[model samples]
Target: MAANNLRGQVLSLYSRLLRMSRNWNATNPAETIVERQYIKEETMELFRKNKHHSEPFIIKECLKEAEARMTMAEHYRNPYPRPVNLPKRSFSKKEGKKIGKAIQKFNEQSRPIYIRSTDDAVGRSS
Candidate 1:
């Protein structure tokens, strides 16, 4: 927040912009890659162009503008913040027709693991 530390503040903002940009995973891999590269190039260019600025007031204004750009990129650039949900294929669909097999369902109560005693009727909880 200090006017004298504009350099550090801008650098922090730049890093944050890059970090948040990586989280964007649109339906297409190419789009995400392009957007990420754009964020990096844009941020670097903006900071590099204003590196020689010495006026505290100008520097403060520049940082504010950079912060606003970062905010817009974070919220507006990517309409979908959460990752795209991919559809899952069933076991039969994944494997070829030759190897396709249906999932098996089993009843545990019918298994031999359970033992019924002669007191089955007398031991009834009801």
Candidate 2:
């Protein structure tokens, strides 16, 4: 039956999303749990919202879009939470603005120095 087929497709998509969600991480365990719960709730809600659609063309198109979304999410999802222990900045917003150029200068100091010479060094003595 068409209804049965549609239900199966929706279930399959939902499970795929859950598996995908497992690969995501948040900065901490509590955040991770919250994120996973949000993902599950949003997914179930989307599928439930469309549960009554019976038209063949609509179902087909919806399935195709779902597949595309799954592929994109799998490919482009963040690999992991950025480290939770990065050094916290002590600067206030105003301090940060005041020291912006100093920060830029500090970063630039790390760059490799480059020297340009017009003469071939081997041919001429210093």
Clashes of each: 0, 0
Off by over 4 Å in 2: 1-3, 26-31, 78-126
lDDT of each: 0.52, 0.53
Candidate 1 residue 101 C-alpha distance from true site, Å: 79
Model 2 agreement with the true structure over 19-109: per-residue lDDT tens digits: 7676666556667776777656655655666567778766665566556555644565532222222134433236435557665454333
Best by TM-score: 1
Per-residue lDDT of 87-108 in model 1, one digit per residue for the tens? 2432322354444223221221
What lDDT, from 0 to 1, does candidate 2 have?
0.53
Ten contiguous residues minimizing lDDT sum, candidate 1: 110-119
Ten contiguous residues minimizing lDDT sum, candidate 2: 115-124
TM-score of each: 0.52, 0.48
Pairs in clash, predicted candidate 1: none
